[model samples]
Target chain A: MAIFRTCPDTGLKIHSQAEALIKANAVVGIVFLAIGGLFGIAVALTRWPAVHLLDPEWFYLVLTAHGVGVLLFWIIFFEMAILYFASAILLNSRLAVPKIAWGAFALMLAGAILTNIAIFQGDSSVMFTSYVPMKASPNFYLGLILFAVGALIGCFVFFATLVIAKNDKTYEGSVPLVTFGAITAAIIAVFTIASGAIILIPTWLWSLGFISYIDPLMYKIIWWGMGHSSQQINVSAQVAVWYAIAAMVLGAKPLSEKVSRSAFLLYILFLQLASAHHLLVEPGLSSEWKIFNTSYAMYLAVLGSMIHGFSVPGAIEAAQRRRGFTRGVFEWLRKAPWGNPAFSSLFISLVLFGFLGGITGVIMGTEQINLIMHNTLYVPGHFHGTVVAGTTLAFMGITYLVVPLIFRREIWMPRLARWQPYLFGLGAGGISLFMMGAGTLGVPRRHWDITFSDAPLSVDVPGTAFLMMGLNGVFAILAGLGGLAFIINIVGSVLIGKRRDKTVARTNPVVFDGGAAVAGYGAEGTMKVPGTVVLVATFFTAFVLYYYVNWKFLSEVWPLS
Target chain B: MAIHPPADRLWWKEPLATSEVIWIAVAFLWGLVMFFTMIYWHFAGEQNLSSEAYKISPEKFAERTEAMAAKYKVREEGDTGVPVVRPPAGTDIYMFGRLWEWWPVLELEKDKTYRLHLSSLDWQHGFSLQPTNINLQIHPGYEMVVTLKPNKTGEFSVVCNEFCGVGHHTMVGRIYVVDAK
Candidate 1:
């Protein structure tokens, strides 16, 4: 299968024979999303006065699993598609190993299952942060490492596919814009996995009593490479999808390719240092380094995002303008097809992500301002802006758009698909905002009961905020129903939808400048990968930064204690 | 498929070599401004000249009675002869030290933006503050900083949120947030 550069070329094809691998990853990803949502509901239940689901013990388990399943599994599996598309489908290539991809899938699934069992069984229930003084069963740690390994191997296959493409040379000039962002994400993901390996492997050794000494402080600094930065990875990958979807659907092209590409690349360059911003309010750190690493270095990453904000919206506006939907700045808004589920999901997700997540993150990243928001529910509220609303919702929306196109079947409930993104974003955004408010009132997270903690705390951030958050979860159940509609749609389309004789081939044979291509017929496809080396090189740098450099600091205790 | 370039290229690309020199000069001047704000701490921390932070034992604390302590000035006496380490409100309480991998091991006062300059005494410590997952690195010599407004009026646990050693789970500290006088 070669990539479709234009419609007339019967050789260029869009449908991936390796979609079984994609569907496999999607199944795993959605399962995690659903389970993570349940854990999220547990958090709401624990916080709310009505249901009271947090068992301290159970809450910890839920927190850990929620972080792993929703944040890690859901996002990463979806990102795998972006990775493959970048290296293969975008380039018109095929998988290096369809079988091994399935193997990686199986490993991740098994790891996920083991992790849930270990956590829910009350083994090692430290929250996702897994900070020191909290212990989980060795299985919990092992499960995490195995899953990371699986994800890493999946990343390797993506790289290999890129290698396969470049070797064949299916296209000319620089890599496509969407491929650039995907590769950048893959780079970040490599570092993230390395960070996980550093922490989990060491902790596993300590858990078994194999090591007499381990440093909690050391583990944490290294952990953020995976923890905080991984969030950025998801953001990068999802935005790449957004760029592709926008271009394909609405004819939106970035206002300035250099600006958008740099914006995405800037994330890779700056996010590693920016992650330390999570540590403000923590003692045993130098003011100078904290200020420099987090405060100064962080703005670069933020600037990248800010640039993205302008460019992406500018692209959309320019596209709409070209289409002659001229009314006003607001007219561009009205002209957008409101009924399109993909458009709705991507647009709203970007809005909430940038407005809510980006703003709060920059404010919280400051050294002086950090003291106010570190451990409280405000932190959760802040991230939900980007991850849940921005990344997860975008992926869900893409599934509605992508799955149907690839499967060649009508979406089972187009009406429901149209509504899912809006409902999920509303519920998540509402809940996260209230959590932030409660945090401002000095509400602490990880407490079984706020009423029981001995920590010296003031500022009663409203009780209703928790109720509001719970209400959001209730709506989330509705959103989940929307998601189920999507799954049923995919299953029905693949298994049962009436197939047309056209076979709904993916690519058009003829290509044009900054515009749509002609549709192609048949299975002939070729993948071009010009920047495969760059992608792997960036990843190599990431791995080195996380493992080799970060490990030195982590391996030895400082201040010569 | 025909791959095509944009119809127009923007005007910014045409630059003279001398512009690099001009640009470099401007960047240097901007860096100079950033230097001033940074230099004070660099010097202050270089010679262990930070004015605040210490390890106080129960005996040293108890021994600072008004009658016994007025001579040493570790604690100041009120009119009633009761001794208290009276750090005034709104003071930039600078704390720079090793937290020994456990917290409650380190105590800070309430009602101030304690400019905490922290680093691990031994291993890297992820200083996680509760109620807010505001976690930061305490790298030796590298310095992780946080400006903390202790708005709460009670004892809050400060623990090594990063998993470190065999006893990592027990690394706990407490900060006593006394009511404002």
Candidate 2:
């Protein structure tokens, strides 16, 4: 028999083994985030032109570390925690093969450590893509391959836990919407890891001198099959976090389960195809393949995200209305839990993601527009909007609740928690905007010096580019402080914050009723969400305008065929 | 709640709200519009990437690049010792990218088209033409042919945007577009 502890606040059955694993993964993930974030500050400062912190060698080295640490290690580790929570904890079932889960974690930790060591040792400074022919140390590829395998094993364990949940009849009907989203992420992860193994293993051998040569074009095509698909995994998990937070904080139910599930289904089917966006400007690929793949087979995956953008906030509006906050279109929003860090972070993430990330992504992914945007600072700017502002912020929001509910502790420095999201969001938002602005002036992405001051041939970059970089530096510092606040609050609460005992009254108990009683479909029959409709309309307008503006920019460039 | 199973067994059968129905229809149509736009641009727009490319060894590409440079050598781009070749309009112009530089500056006649051949000798590099902002990826062993027509005459800078090596920042080339007299 597996030991289970009943959560005092939510009254859900938490399997002890699953809880420990979740805590362990999350703690390790945070450590990587801190390390990666420090590297990020150095990168931002170096790119600032005026600040110009690191030398050329150290700049590239730290940039590579930053990418691997944050993009790969930190995100994946937290996602591993999310996989466990979605499977075992959400289903109220014991984890399957707990011992194997521990082994997976250990392998992942070892891989991450090895990769970091290889990177810091000063030979393997290849950017995250590691686009070979520019070979790094053998340990670099080995570390990544091992990390990918460990993550692959973790995915299988998640699947096994889902099977156990079904067999034990832990819940009724289909799994929850959030778990369904996790299933989408896990499926994508399996495909992504397979792609990594197929490519990276051979690249690893070539690094070891076992193979003679690797085709650069072939490497890129297959590498993106892993690289870009991993980001799609982030998108899936982030959306799931959005839904989970809405439900927990507002007691919000999905506006329509069918619509949301179908969206997740769309993600599983077509999201990986967006990897072609990276290859839009590459040689040898036909325009037909580029158009088909970059658009996700007619933008079906984009359609999925559009559906989610509406449904998440729509659900929130409906719930707020039910609580008698229904005076005007804006009342429900105005009366929302602005003081609560969880709600505030989710709202900020939703807005910045739609405006900055989603809009820029579609514009840049356009076949012709890619000519202007590919390999430019614009690429990084666009992703920071999505991964950092969109995904990372959502994860931080959930941590506020995760601490109180899972760790059973009161939030330490509640005041700082309230302001952290805004600080981070504003800073990240600025970084994305300024970087894109500089890129518009033709600033390169991975170049240590945009000014080209020491080059054999010098080119004059406009003064506006310098201003943008300086502003980006300022935002990086602000974002650093915000990140520090999050770390301190989370760590302090976990270590020595007040523990919730039976005597402590649960002011805002997380309402988990095991989904008993038939909740009404479609917001109590004639659903009225004027606020959500208006909000989505504005988003659509911004997207449309931005798309055309990029086309206009493309038109001004030198003519090509 | 999102964390719990649906209250109804047949949740899939539930009806969507009027707003959601309208939004989905709008979104789907917009997706179609975005998809067709790329295809439309190929036909209607002047700036589309050509599908013309060939597979060539690094040695062969280097020989071709140097041959074209020696034949059309007009001047040397001051002390750098790199050749400045002024290939005739409507001819094949070759520019090679290698370890740390974009070889042999090319001068072109404004408003005239040239079959520009781009290839890398060793690693992958990005062909980023600054000020005008046109970019393409250059990979070793594959020669990409771009149809280029310079509409405006200026001293354009060709910067290697792709991270080739530690010296990537120093890998800058020149392209001068003179008046078609």
Candidate 3:
């Protein structure tokens, strides 16, 4: 009753239902990526001040669309594809409920369309948070509810697929390391979707006047459980992809299977607590809640990331060393496949995410330090590092392999693919850094203009802040171009590229060991990861310096008498 | 190659490498340091806005703000058209955020603490004190109390960082901190 075709390239048994679902989700994800990305570039140009592309009305509307389309629709759609691939294809088992999967996809598609239409219709310009008392149409809340339910259903299917794999005895022992990471993401998605439903259903009724009032403070607290934790899901899935790419490209296993898996388990327990960072400045919440969530417990989640941060590249280093690149500390790193876009993007993502996203996140998460950076341009700057450079970039890196393996098509622009990561990474990384720099000098996020020329009381922005926005604008344009290149490459490959079969020699294809289950633990000789240790040390030094600098900045502010 | 399940091994039961143990321990120690730092900052240092907050009616908040303005009326000319209200040192000051403006532009003394109470009349707004860059969300029904002690003696700009509506960018307030007597 089940038909599985072996992918000639990756050599993994892909279920027919899974191949269709992955393709559909990926294609839809790309479509929204284009829609949202176009709005994103416009937003950048507008924020540039020199350009100031759209007026306030259109700016807010496009921003709302951009947030929903890219942040929610595009990323989640791609994540769904990932869920299906990780469970059904990686486990080499049939999807548990193919019909239910299709229904879920349909609901998601309907929801995405309805929300975009509501936003574009220009009444519901409430930004992504959509904080309460600022009302939107009934359609807006309804659309979101539908989408959350659909995603919830998809999460259930992912769980069901794992169950089918277990019952059918698809694998000999434990699920693969990558599959384990996906499981973490799925669990987080369950929590996120449930949180969304709890708040959104009531909000929907309120829009219809079925309910009188929804408390603003209560809305914010519940919304972030869905909003911020959704990104945590991305973090988990991207880390999983990091492991998968390393294994597929270089025959690498995790440095320590137990350690890596424990890190993921930590995500399940503590990552959602990080959502409390958004409510730190809210008047309703007490300091006890804030301190507990942001510093004490949330630190465990940070530790999880630090663990993966070391283990991923460590695995890569050990694998490279085993292949005889073992000269100096960084010989293995330097001798890596820099020519491969997959490797370069993954490496770039890891570095930018750790240095920029991770460091800034820890700084902002600090209760006292958050005072200086809350609601500033620094907020978006921090997230761009995580979601764009970290998750989106990682996803882009893996797509190179996905095209060859799933779509059975060679990349159309091989030359362009090589430079895509650097262009995007440098541009996006600059956008993030410059925005944070401007925010430090006191530029507010969500403000159409920092100048406030027409305002009753004008703000005095230092000259450097303006310069930062100008540079941010230029880099945003560059990032837009880089995103364009990625879109063109992926779309062209999926649409018109030549197909490959068993006759064609696959380059860097994932070679599976015949019927011999490989435990994730490397042998003692393969555990020579001095280069990775050095890199992790460098990361920590940078993190400490940055964290120290922010505290010093906070200290310089007005003292309480 | 015939597809095979992974080796029959419980990978989670395996021992961690030396590097894994060392890094996890170090990271955990760093976390503990951060946790302790938060405690120190809250109790020992003049950092963090851990002040008392309570719920208030928007109408009552508006009335109290008006009464305060009348109580400490200042004739000094202010920026734009908004009037300046200089409340004396160590007093409870009310600043209400309405559709597009912060009421009773309060002038405070330098190096003296004032319990500044902020609430919104219509929608949620951001109490973003710029230059200093201390921001807090001002919800309509809730009073956010911040202990403000301005070290510098100059007019500080108040920018609403939260997106309220179409005129969100132009919503600005002022807090003039004069030299201490």
Candidate 4:
């Protein structure tokens, strides 16, 4: 029988097997983050016209490495940890198959290492897209195949754990909202992994020359279902973490649990359709197919996000008000714990992801608007907003809480932890804004240099774009430093920070307050979230302004009648 | 942290607060409006390049482009020695994207619409028109027909934005919209 040690703070029983897996996955994720982040700094510096660090070949190589490392390896690894934690810990169930979980971990590690080796060896400098006919070494595709299969297996294990929890009758009605969010993420992971299998298995064979030809258009249409949907998994998981952090840090419950759950269900159904936006400008797809995929039913996914956008902050405000912080409408907003990394980072993630990532995504995903933004640096700017500012920051925030709860150690550098979110959020927000600005001025996304001096005709972009790229470089450095601070705090805390005494663990559970109002779900209150309503109103105003500004800019482009 | 399950585990089953329902309604209504706006833009003067495309062989595309270049090549004074082909207004024009170059600098008459047929010989490439900021993804075995009427007569550079190997950044094509005197 597996041993279960209930966390003294959260009171959720944690399986020894689950704790080990979470630690292993989180450590690996941080390692990939470090490697990918270094590559990111190089990429940023090279894009800075003043620096122009790498030559063409090396730039492409580093770009490929960076994309695979950060986007694929780091995020997926951490999500695996989250899947395990959400299921086994939150549900208070033993891991369904611990040995099988280890196997999945091994396969993932092998795949990541193999892919990196192929890229560094230079035959696989095909960038992340790896469009067919421009082939890479067989190992690149093989690596991705292994990774996807591993992740798929891990997801099944998560589902199994949920089943175990249900069968065991381990506390609850409809599985807490946090675990519900994880279930949504796990479902999306299944679809994303399947899409990867459908495309990558054949691509692996083609790379080895066993297969004769791969249609470029066919490859793109199928590949983005994997490519873009993979990000949707992150979105689902990140949103889950946001919910978890809110509840754990502030003892805040969902404003309406059913509404939040419905929004997650919407993600599983419609988020993948957003992938079609990537192929909107590609030949072979009809205007009807493009428009239908981008708008008709796809807006439901956007609606899902909008729902979460309002509800998350709304939940917090409602929680705050119940604690008697109800003097004025804005009292709840003013009384937030800005110093706690858990609160600060999640809050920043919400704001940046919505204003920068969410609004820009809607505009860019618009079929007509996609024509202008698809291949520019704007594409990267959009993702960095979502993945880095949104997902990575939220994950970082949770890690602060997780370190103490799971690892059983106090955070080592408490002072540095407080400032980490602001430094990173500000820096990352800058990167997104500057890149979008440069991209709007027509800077190419993957091009090594915008000023083609050696070419027959010298290309001259606006001086402002050069300034934007330079600023992006500076921000990358700042974000890199913030990432460094987080790593130090986490590693130092886990390895050397003082462990809690047994009495301390039992007596001082991670509760924010012992007050009945703080812990309750605010079922009896009026549920008036005036502060969040005002904040969301501000968000809408910005969204509307940015939305029309892009349209106005589109009107100035070439008159294609 | 001592864990305390919610006082009401079926909190979701409880009625939603008026505020929650109202916010959901507002967000959903906004989404509907946005969706309709896209539909409206599609019909009313949205400058998206027409999707109209067909399948083509790499060899056939290369052959037709070579023939057109041979027939219309003109070496004018101060030309960069790259061959410039001045075709008539309102004709079907072919562009071959091969290896690391977009072939045959095209010269078109200002204010006259031309149907440009674009395809790649080996790999996928991006047809990004700079200074004007129009971008389209071009791939092998597919012909993209973009009906473009150049209103401003000037030099516009077509930069290949897709990562089609290392020399992709250098793959620039030229378009000259000359005044038809």
Clashing residue pairs, backbone N/CA/C < 3 A, model 2: A561-B50
Summarize candidate 2's per-residue lDDT along A458-495 as a digit string, tens digits: 89799999999999899988888888899999999999
**Residue A12 in candidate 3, Cα distance off native in Å:** 2.5
Question: For every candidate, what is the interface RMSD in angstroms?
Answer: 12.3, 1.4, 3.0, 2.5
Instruction: Give the lDDT of residue A104 in candidate 3.
Output: 93
Error of 4 at A427 (Å): 1.1
- Residues A1-561 of candidate 4 have per-residue lDDT tens digits of 899887777667889999999999999999999899999999999999999999999999999999999999999999999999888998888999999999999999999999999999999999898998889899999999999888989999999998998999886656777777888888888888888888888999998888998998888888888899889898999988988887887777777776888999999888877668788789868777887787638488888888899888887887778778998888887898898899999999999999989999889988778778879999999989999999999999999988888899888988999999999999899999999988888888988988886566656678999999999999999999999999988999999987965686666555464468765553433477878878888998998888888888877776664
Computed on C-alpha atoms, the DockQ of candidate 4 is 0.55
lDDT by residue for model 2 (B46-152), tens: 99999899999999999999999999999999899999999999999999899889998999999899999999999999999988999999999999999999989
Cα lDDT computed for each candidate against the true fold: 0.59, 0.90, 0.85, 0.85
- Model 3 misplacement above 4 A: A296-298, A505-526, B1-8, B76-81
Each model's TM-score, in the order given? 0.73, 0.98, 0.97, 0.97
Question: Would you list the clashing residue pairs of candidate 3?
Answer: A517-B6, A517-B7
Q: What is the lDDT of candidate 4?
A: 0.85
Error of 2 at A282 (Å): 1.0
Model 1 docking grade: incorrect
Q: What DockQ class does candidate 2 belong to? A: medium
Candidate 3 interface RMS: 3.0
Please write out the lDDT profile of model 3 over residues A1-561, one tens digit for every residue. 778898775566789998899999888988998889889888988998888999999999999998999999999999999999899988888998989999999999999999988998999999988999999988998888888888889999999999999999877678888888999999999999988998999998999999999999999989999999999999999999898888777777777777888899999999888778898788857777888898638389999999999999988887787777889898888889887888888999999999989889989989888888889999999999998889888999888888888888888899999999999999889988998988888788888988897777767888898899999989888888888999999999998977767765354353433122333334222276888889999999998888888889988888742
* Candidate with best TM-score: 2
List chain A TM-scores, every candidate, in order.
0.84, 0.98, 0.97, 0.98
Superior by DockQ: candidate 1 or candidate 4: 4
